[model samples]
Target chain A: MKAVGINGYGTIGKRVADAVSAQDDMKIVGVTKRTPNFEAKRAVELGYDIYMSAPDRENLFEEADIPVKGTINDLYDKVDVIVDCTPGGVGAKNMADYEKAGVKGIFQGGEKHDQIGRSFNSFSNFKESVGADFTRVVSCNTTGLCRTLNPIKELAGINKVRAVMVRRGADPGQVNKGPINSIVPNPPTVPSHHGPDVQTVMKGLKITTMAILVPTTLMHQHNLMVELDSSVSVDDVLDVLEKTPRVIPVEASSGLGSTAEIMEFAKDLGRPRGDLFEIAVWKESLNIVDNELFYMQAIHQESDVVPENVDAIRAMLEMETDPQKSIAKTNKNMGIIG
Target chain B: MKAVGINGYGTIGKRVADAVSAQDDMKIVGVTKRTPNFEAKRAVELGYDIYMSAPDRENLFEEADIPVKGTINDLYDKVDVIVDCTPGGVGAKNMADYEKAGVKGIFQGGEKHDQIGRSFNSFSNFKESVGADFTRVVSCNTTGLCRTLNPIKELAGINKVRAVMVRRGADPGQVNKGPINSIVPNPPTVPSHHGPDVQTVMKGLKITTMAILVPTTLMHQHNLMVELDSSVSVDDVLDVLEKTPRVIPVEASSGLGSTAEIMEFAKDLGRPRGDLFEIAVWKESLNIVDNELFYMQAIHQESDVVPENVDAIRAMLEMETDPQKSIAKTNKNMGIIG
Candidate 1:
């Protein structure tokens, strides 16, 4: 089995470890945490080899009655690849260590795209990251847009795409991150950083993105208006999207409507933390009038990129060069389609 | 006071009656219900003169311990005007009766635009129905599109307007309504009736629409993309929207993000039934990209037209010729903008 080590056992790290653990071709070697918090203990309970990021903090894990394997560097020596989920800027600093240790690393979106020469979004540009030592999994929102836009571009050809990204204020677990009573634009400017981030994975797509951070912590909703090169019916658009492995269509008849209902569906499906790892596309919302197609889809911030991370590993190691096969394996192993 | 009678005491009718009660120029003469349901009783409790649509069901109210004031014709004879709130197709049948009674009437979206010679939307084309005795208030989705589009049309002018209407399956109270688990297109056809409905009010606009009904009780979200006559600044678009009384800017800082939070905000504002009678525009989501202006806004289905109903009453009676003044009074009495 290809061994995968994840640094920073927080939201994304823990999820990536779980995803990698589910894969047949790969195994999770270890997960690193800076502090001996509840999540660290939870990681130990999941049977992951726990490594302390700071060697000085080894005693704290022991005091908390959580067993520790070694330091983060020690994990690099053992694993074939490392998925860096360290808080944003910290991943940039850790890149040098990853290079010196001679292990491939996958950085999360929080890190700058320039940190890794090639940015990865599983299906959109999986081939671009082939044989690359380091690849960054674009942010959850960017991944959603790329996954969505790429299909439309291939199937119908894009003329101009405009998307209004309604982002969540915080993750459900983030207690302190919010303006609680107000809608705040992350940056009080025109054309948010999201569109440029999409370019990192999907180049040559003329797209403009505007975002607003809302109070809900469930998922980020993206309202996309894609103008196609030629006219395509709503049926044709829905068929293409439905065939995409990671796009989960939210139906009206299942009695699930809101993001709240979707969360309940995930929990009922026995998913950990009720995380919806796929882009929940409102099936009914898919409509094309004239040459333009419009749909609204929700992206689960923490877990959407988890499956991408698994595929990114496959891409980096050349274990599965074909995106379709790799994504199929990841989606199947994670019980994505029930 | 001008006597205004509501011909159906359902979702839109009850709310319309409440709005009329709040206005100084008009009074709710009575409301009609086919059966003595709980809502009919609530209409009585709200002090509306309860008119029985089917005289045979008048005793049903007595059996339900509810009081009935008179038959439908009795209400027509007593009131100066009628607002038909019955379901679609039912209003078309009632139109002939309204004309025979020589009582001016207002019809809800369920009726065909041709059923009433003049189609009405409060601010958009209040003047168009200056002396027309009968007017039909457009559907909830059309109202939302008009509220957002009219301002843009006035400020920048539109080369083309495209919208995708993501409609709710049913009101929270409509338990039997919806596909429940399937995202079904309303007509299973391109260009839903909503686009033509908008034309009934604002004529000669190049527009197209598609719609899907999802399982949600709260509101309908309209994803709009407008190509303007000339490129305008993002601030300029926002300035125009902010100045419109019926268009509410949902701030990101107020911690109000989703329709759920906006509904809660309405509840906290002590609105009756927590109804937000204005369009909740995501201010932060508004952006102008290379002559294309994009934004996402939600219309609370139940009460949005209530304010329009109040405005329509003034327009029908020539009570307030200025839409700005009529809309202002409607907003003030309803506590729309504090």
Candidate 2:
């Protein structure tokens, strides 16, 4: 099994560790934390091969009730890949440490798109990340857009895309960051950074996005309108979307629910961490007037990038030429694919 | 039988004329027009008692081939109620003319909110206009909001309402107004008039509305997040909505379609003048995190308000009392309300 190491065992990191452990071809060799938090203590008690000392809590593992031992460098040496789940830009700035350790690394979505060698959404363009030394999992919005747009590109040649994204503010963990009662223009400027990021991933597609941040922690909803190169019906578009592996088309029959309901559905479906495809579409909202305009909603941001990190790790390991095929094989070996 | 006079022969007026003609208790006295338009000529040929000339074309009826002939004042005298399908503010200014002729009047939505004695939205508060002399129809956006809100109010008392109304620039007939590419803020300001108008008619419900106008002539889509007075589950909310009259709960299974599809569905259901209910909700979009927040999209204006005008006319004439009762009566009278 390819040994994997995770840095930053927070909510996302812990989930990533769990996802990696579930993969038959992968093993959680170690996880690093700067402090001995509840998650770190739990990871130690689970008997992981190594518990790398975070800079601040360098001696916590040795003082644990059931002592765990390892220096950060030794933990890095044992793993074939390390995932930096550090917050935002910290991952890119400190990526050199993982690179020098001779282990391939993955960066979180918080890092700028340019920081990583390749940016990826597992279902949209996983194959493109194969053999890359460092990959960045895109922010949730980009991941959601890729999942929605990839299917459209494959089936419908799009001429232009216009989107209005209603984004939720910081995750629950972040404190006092929003104008909770008002819908604020993110970046408080036209053509926000989130919009450009959408265009960057779907580089060939002519896409423009406008974002408004609402006070919510659950999920962002993208109201997308597209002008396709040719005429297509709503059924044709739904067919293409349904075929995309990672997207869960919010059905017409399902009564309306919140983002939490969507996430719950994702959990019940046995989706791996970061594999939540909560696309809630309003059928009446999709208008293909004549052959020119098509409307839809794509949801994404930080939380969605989790699965992309996992896919990037698999790609960097060079275990599968085709990422989907590799994932299928891995799942079969884990007895989860069937 | 009440003799109903149509003061304009535009799309709405013509439709109103047909609807009234079908009513057993209502008879078309005459239609007034500024020019000898095809609709006016058709109404004349159909053996109407008179064809009144608009102020500018008072002499046209004098030279008409058909026997039907009269001045605008003459037609006003014969009808018990006059339906003013004139453009915005025009009906308000001309209200005295109808009252002077001893006629009760129905004004279209374009009239200012306070100009007429009462504002009518058949299902929500038509009975309030039972004995009222003059009634103005509410705008389409307000009509859609009322329809959506009324059901929710019945289930859980709404303490506050926040809405983002995205409106289309112009209707299909207004094709001369092109360059429908940009999404412009409606009213280009906060505290939009549309919001307060809805609040006024909702019996002083605390509501704030923000609007964006796009370059499409289709229906408007409202992104509404309401704060209820009490907590309610999503299932309970859906159950309440599904049973609400005039508010058709569109399920995810119905698939996606445009405003036109919704209009077509209303038509197929034989909804009178297509004044039926429409609330296409994505179950995942609703969030009742606390006792407060609920998010949804209200139907845009055109398809919504136009039919509301028909209901307003019925309410003005005291043809029905309760909006649902009126809708049922009107539908049955029109051979559609089973």
Candidate 3:
């Protein structure tokens, strides 16, 4: 089994740690925490060997009576591949340590695309990262976009695309973040950063994106419009999306209406953490206007990329040559089924 | 001067009363209220007589010690034109009373297009409503779309259009309204009701719209993309929009970034009720991708249609023969000069 070390045990880090633990092909060696908070204690409760992210600040954990396995460097020495879930810029800073340990590094979407030189989405660009030294997972929104669009592009050949992302103001755990009573145009500009981020994985995709932060912590809703090279019926588009592994086609007729209702559905399914790893494409919202395909999908911001991260680990370590098999393994292990 | 009766003393009703009071060619005869609410008391305090909408329930006002002038019929009888601002379906129910009074009736956007048979946007269909018995002012979002698209349609013919409206969760005064922590797709459907409603006024204008309700009371932001018949540059589009009355172009560099800042700017300008009578289009967001023009504009949901209501009144009564002249007069009286 490949040994995986998760760097940073915060929102994404803890989830990645659990996802990696759930996989049969790999086991989490340890997880690092900067401070000895409740999550650090939970890591210990979950039988994870907690490492000090900042070795110099080890006293913080010691004072809180939390036992540390070792420093981050020690954890790196024991693992074959490390998923760097450290918040944005910090992962780039951890690059040298990864290089020194001679281990493959899989960075989260938060990092800049240039940091690892290769952006990854299993369905779109898995082969590009096979046995590579490092790869970066695109953000949740980009992963959500690519998962749906890449298949359609292959089927119909896209001419151009426009998407407006209604983003959650904050993650459920992020209590302090807000536009609590406002919808702020995130960049307040045309073709937001997400469009180019999708281009990083699925090269030369002609898409422009605009994002607005709404007062919600459940999920980000993407209203996507694509002009295709050929005409398509609503069923033709639905057939393609329904067959895609990680894209779940939900129907309003099923009484699953909004993101709120979808979240409740996830909880009803007994999903761990009530996390929805798949992009919930409202089947009712999917429609075809001539050669254009339009639909709105909800991306659970915290969990959509969790499965992608697992598949990336498989790609970087050459654990699975077939992306479909790797995706099946990750989804099955995470209890994601149609 | 034409005498006007506002047949609902609620959000839109009160704002229309103030706007009409400011106009040179109209006078507020009275306003109707269903109960002895604070707004009814405030209307009397402001020196405008209050009429009981349900005359049989006049005891409700008497018990609350608020005097009622007469029944809604009494107010309708004294007015030459009545602006029906009752909530949604209620306005349609008030239609027969208007017909019996032998007065021209103006309806708010909430009422269905078939209720009046003619929809009015001072810019797009002003002439259509001139000397007509009744005209319905389009909703705030539709009004915002028409104000910008109508000018662009006139300058460089529009081929097709798509818009995503990030709507506010509630009007600020709507204390109990919510989506408090969720971004609910208002309809979760393609080509929402706003698109068809726009066609009611700007006929044959091909457009598809999608909307989501965010947690905000300030304004609704629309991200619009239009395929024009001819190639146009950013400057070409901006020039047309800048020349359009009641569409104000705002720049991010000028420290007006989002709807929150724009609303604050309105208050800073000492606009009555901090109302923004114009659609604030982000000048920086106006860009052209070949034959397509893309931009985002903010619609102050409370008051963007206030000026439209005033101009619709002019069109139905032939108070101003020219649409531009009526628009200019309405904007000037409401202090909406650039």
Candidate 4:
């Protein structure tokens, strides 16, 4: 089994660590935490070796009733690949340390594409990460877009895509982040970087994206308008999306509507932390009018990238050569349904 | 002053009556109810003269301690106009009674547009209803589109418009309706009739709409994609939307993002029934990409058309000549913020 070490145990990091543990060909070496907090203790409880971020902070874990296996340096030495889930820009700082250890490095959404040679999304660019030293998993928004876009590209050539990314300000546990009472044009500029970031995986894609940050910590909703090179029916678009592994067509008949109900359903389904790892598209909203297809879908902020990280591990380590095999294994092991 | 009576005192009827009561140019003659339910008693408490739909059921109201001032015919005899707020297709049946009484009839969205010569949304076809004998108000979803599209059509020139109406399965008080389990492809067909309903007012406007009913009761979220005649900047689109009378630019800095938060804000603003009479557009999500303008907005399914109903009363009676003056008066009286 390929050993995987997680360099952070925050929101994405902890999720990544869990997903890594779920993989068939991968095993978790350890998880690094800066603070000896609840998550650190919980990691220990879950039987994960807690690697303190700093070697000197080992006593902090001891006092906090948390046990540690070693420092992050020890984690790097023990692993074939290390996934960096530190905050934005911090991943870039950690890149050199990863390179020094000679283990492949994987970064989360917060880091810029230039910090890594390639951006990895299982839907489109999983193969591109093969033999690469570093890969950045696209943001939750980008992953959702790519998952839906890949099918459209294969079924029908897309002329252009204009999407509005209605973002949630923070994950549920992120109390520090908020514009809580208001919505803002984040970046306060036209065409937020999401479209270009999507271009990192999809070369030559004509897409312009706008983002609005909302107060909810549940999920981000995307409003997409895609123009096909040729006329297509709404059914044609639905067929493509339905075929995509990560696209779950949400229907009112399922007694679920709104992100709130979706979360409730996840809990009912016994999802870890009630996370939905698939792209939830409003099935009835799909339409082709005057040669244009319109639809809306919700992206669960924290968990969507988790499955992609699993697939990325296989790609970085060359464990599973087939994309579908890796994705299916990752999804099945994580109990992810689309 | 135009004398107006509401037929059927449920969701749309009661709201229409309250809006008429708020209008300086109109007065409520009475409102009819078939059942002596809580809404009927509440209408009495709100100082509306309650009339029984079936005069024979007058005893039901009397037994329920709800006093009635008159019968449906008595309301018809006194009012110059009657607004039909009954269930779908019931408005068509009531059309003849309105004609027999020599009173103009206003139908809500539930009615088929062909029941009346024109479908009215104050923003789009308010003027067309002037001097017309019968007018049908567009659906709440259509009202939202018209509110946003009118500004775009005049300011940027819309080449085509495509939208997905993510609907609420029922109103907040509507405990009866739901597909609740799944998001079914409603109409199960392409280009649902909402676009045609909008066309009835906009006149040859090239637009198409698909609808998905979700299990939420608060409001309906509309995803809109408009192809502009020319390339406009994001600021340019903002400028036009700002000028629109009933379009509220939703900013995250104000701490509101989801429809639920918008409702909370509305209640905090002291709006009756926590009703927002304007279209709430996520301002930051507005973008002009590749000359295509995209955005997302929400319509409080019950109250969005309330102000429009007030304006439609004026239109049918020729009370206020300019549509803006009527909409402005109604909005100010109802405390609607654009």
Candidate 5:
């Protein structure tokens, strides 16, 4: 079994731990938390091997209810791979530590693209991350765009892509955080930071993005209009989307439920919480008159990055010859049938 | 027989004239145009009783290949009902002339809500305009919103309705209109003029709207987020929309087509474009957690409003008493049978 260590135990981290535990070939050997929170206490009760008391401390495992001694250096020897689910810049700070420890590491979405050796999107750039010791799973917005845009680019070849993303303020579970009413434009500028990140994942694709932050703690909705190099019919577009793996086309009758609804649908469809790409298309919105302009909406964010992180780990480990097959095998091992 | 006169033989006007002529109770008595346009010549060649020249003082018959004699004043006396298909604001300007001629008139979507005594929406507000002598059909945006909102309001009682309408720059056949690549916020402001027009038609319902102008001339898409008074499930919302009289639920297997595809689907389903409400729902967008917020996109303007305008005229004439029965009769008369 491949021993895995999780360096943070927050919402995404806990879910990642659960997902990793569900994998047949992976075992959760250790989990570290900065403070003794409810989830951390629970992780301790479950009997992990090497539990560090703090993320930054070199030697501190004594804070646990049951006293144990271990240094950060000790954790490096315990697990073959470590997943750093720390906030944005923090992952880069610890990258040198992970490299010196000689363990493969997974970075979260908050980390900037340049911070890691490779940016990962399982469906699009899984092969690029092969044999890289450190990889960054892209932010949710980029992940959602890549999943939808990849198929369209493969079939239609986009000339110029324009997008307007309506993002939520917070998670439904986050308290004192959100439930915003106004639709505030993100960056208040035409090309947002999020847009360039999407470009990073889809190199050579000329794309522009705008975003509006709405008051909701669910999934973000991206209104994407693509000017393709060639013209295609709506039927042709739908055929391409249907054939693209990891994209879940929400039928008009199905009624796009909510972020929770999408997540639940993903679970029902056997996709991990963030592995879903729920596209709710308005047929009329697909203006194929000249067949060059194609319009659609893509939903994405944090939860989706988890699956990419898993695929990145498998690719970096070179567990299988074909990266896609390895990713597929990992998905099956994690019980993600979709 | 009611003598139907068509003033302004444009695309919609010509279709209206053709549709009315097909009815046994309606006859094409007179058709008018500003100049001896091709359609005017065609109308004269079709052998109607009189061909009245539009705004121009000269008689069109004298100028035509087939010698005839009539002015605008002559047409006023010859036809019982004059359908004003002139450009915006022009309909209201000519309304008094038609009324003075003792002719009941039908106005297209160009006239503002305040310009007419009564506004008509075939599915939602047709009964309100019944027996009214001069009725203006609500704009395509209002018609689209009413079709989707009215049913939900009737079934679920909305608390607040927030909408973002992405409108097409020009109707099909309009000239020098669109760059087709740019998306500008319509009116470049929130609570656009179109919003109040929609509110005026939806009197007694509380709603707010935003508008964006896109390059496509096909159809307008209204992204609506509605807060219902009570909690509801996605299934419940879908059930209500599917069972609603005029709303046609686009099936999943149909794939995402254009407004034209959806309109064709409505036609195939035997629903007249005017009374037909083609709804592509995002059930997950319906945040029923508190069972309050519901998000959906409604297709409007362009072809969707054409059938509604027809039904509005039928309703104004009091041709049928029961609204549902009238819609059915109108659909049958239009030969929109599946």
Candidate 6:
């Protein structure tokens, strides 16, 4: 069994820590937080060792009566891999610490793709990450894109992909982020970074993406128009998507019409934190016009990548060399569905 | 001057009444309300005559100390045209009453296209509405689509159009309507009604639209991917959109990064109720990869159609035969700027 230490006890960090704990071949040795907030106290209650990210600010925890398992360096000493969930650029800054400690680092998508050298989505680049010392898990949106597009590309081949990503303005817990009552063309530019981000994982894919931020906190929705190499039936497209791991084909007929309903379904299914690790594709939205395939999918931003992080850890530690087997193990342990 | 009766003093109705009051060629003879709501009281304070839609419900208004200006029939008898602002489907139910009253009926987008026999977008079909007895102003989204696409079609000819409409979940005061925290694939079906609705105005235009409703009350944003008949420079495309009536090009650099800022900009500009009648297109989002043109535009759902309603009235009454002249008159009277 490999020991995993989660470096950041926030949204993605806390979830990854739980998922790693559930895996039979891996365990969360500890999780880190710079502040003695409610999440830090909750981590203590869950009996996970809490590591302080800021070595000099250890007193903040003592005053809040939240016990600490020494600083991040000490956690690194006990773990074989560190899953860094520190906000975006901060992960890049934390890279040196992981390097100095000689621990394999699994970074989140926020960091620059070049900084980590490899960008990963279990569905797209699992084999490429095996036995690597470090790899970055792409953001929720990109991971979602790769999971669906890579499968379709393998099935009928793709000439090009044009997607419009309607992203949520903020996560439920993120009170500061906004577009609060507006829809913003996030970068207000063509192929807004996401298309190029997807290229980081699935190389040589012809894709262009444009995104807008909406005043929603539930999930990001992507409307994809893929120009296939040849004509394909809607059933054939749906077949590939339904068979793909970590993708659930939700139909409007099932009353799972929107992201809200999907999230509610997750809660009903007893998923932790009402999280949906799978991408929910609207089966009713699948359509074919000659060579073009259009469909819509919802990405639960906070949890979709949590399972990806678990798979990345296994790949980096070489515990699971086969991509499919690793993905299966991660899914089974986390209770992820098709 | 045409005397206009605004039937249904709700969200669209109240705004249309105010807009009509501002126009020199039109005046709101009266507005109808079913009950003595706050809006009804506000309508009275505005010094406009208030008509009771439910004549039997007049006692409800009398008990609330609000005076009624006879029944809807009384207002219709005095008006040359009636701008039906009733909710969707509700307007269709009132069509027979309009026919009996012998008043030219101008319906909101909520009603069916066949019910009114013609759909009007001043920029797209004002001339077609001239001397007509009835014309339905397309919904805010359809009006917005026609304004931009028609201009572009005239400029470079559109081969096809694909749009993803990220719609607002509820109007500002519609606390009852929702997916309050979710992003919904409105119909969760390919080519949502919007595409067919647009076809009602810009006939023979190849287009497909998919809409997702998000938790917001400010505006609806459209991400349009238009395949042009031939290559066009970004400047040329921008020129066409910039010169279009009822369309304003906004940039992120100006801090109008999202709909919230745009709404705030409207408030700052002294627009009543902070409503944006013009579609705010993100100038920086305008880009062309060969013949495929991509851009994002925001439609203030509450008011974008207000000016369209005004123009439809002028057309049906033959107050202006030239579409351009009517559009200019409507824009100037309502302070609409590109």
Best by DockQ: 6
lDDT of 2 by residue, A1-338 (tens): 89888877776677677767867778788877766667667777666644554544545655754344565687877888888887778888778888788878888777887767577666656777788778877777777777777777777787766566666666656677753333334432224466567655667766655565555555676666566877778888877766655555663236322355555565676765433534544343454643544344435343455555666788888877686776455444332321
Clashing pairs in 3: none
Better of 1 and 6 by DockQ: 6
Stretches of model 3 off by over 4 angstroms after superposition: none
Overlapping backbone residue pairs in candidate 5 total 18
- Candidate 5 per-residue lDDT, tens place, A1-338, comes to 78788877776777778777877767787777776556766776766644553545433344446433364566778787888887678888889999888998988778888878578887777778788888888887888888778888888788866566666656656678632222333443335677688766788777766555554565676666576877677778877766655565554235432344455566676654444533434333444534444444435454666666666767777754465676566556665433
Q: Give a tens-digit lDDT track for model 1, residues B193-299.
A: 88888988889888877665554567776667788997788889888888888888887557655666788888998889899888988777677777878777878
- Candidate 2 deviant stretches above 4 angstroms: A45-53, A59-68, A267-284, A292-303, A327-338, B1-338
- Alpha-carbon interface RMSD for all candidates, in angstroms: 7.1, 17.7, 1.3, 6.7, 17.3, 1.0
The weakest ten consecutive residues by lDDT in model 5 chain A span A178-187
List A-chain TM-scores for all predictions.
0.97, 0.86, 0.98, 0.97, 0.86, 0.98
Q: How well is candidate 5 docked (DockQ)?
A: 0.02
Worst 10 residues of 4 chain A by lDDT: A180-189
Best by lDDT: 6
Q: What's the distance in Å from true for residue B158, model 2? A: 37
Output the worst ten-in-a-row residue range by lDDT, candidate 6 chain B.
B179-188
Q: Between the candidate structures 2 and 3, which one is better when assessed by TM-score? A: 3
Model 4 lDDT per residue over B36-148, tens place: 99999899889989888886886788899999987898888888888899998889998998898898998989888876768898878778889788999898888888889
- Assess candidate 5 and give its lDDT: 0.64
lDDT by residue (tens digit), candidate 6, B167-276: 88989899899867788888788889899999988989999898888888888889999999977799998888788888889888999988888998999989999989
What order do you get sorting by TM-score, best first? 3, 6, 4, 1, 2, 5
Better of 1 and 5 by TM-score: 1
Candidate 5 Cα deviation (angstroms), residue B209: 14
Q: Is candidate 4 or candidate 6 better by DockQ?
A: 6
Clashes of 3: 0
Best by TM-score: 3
- Model 5 residue runs over 4 Å out of place are A45-50, A53-71, A257-287, A293-295, A298-300, B1-338
Judged by whole-model lDDT over C-alpha atoms, candidate 1 comes out at: 0.82
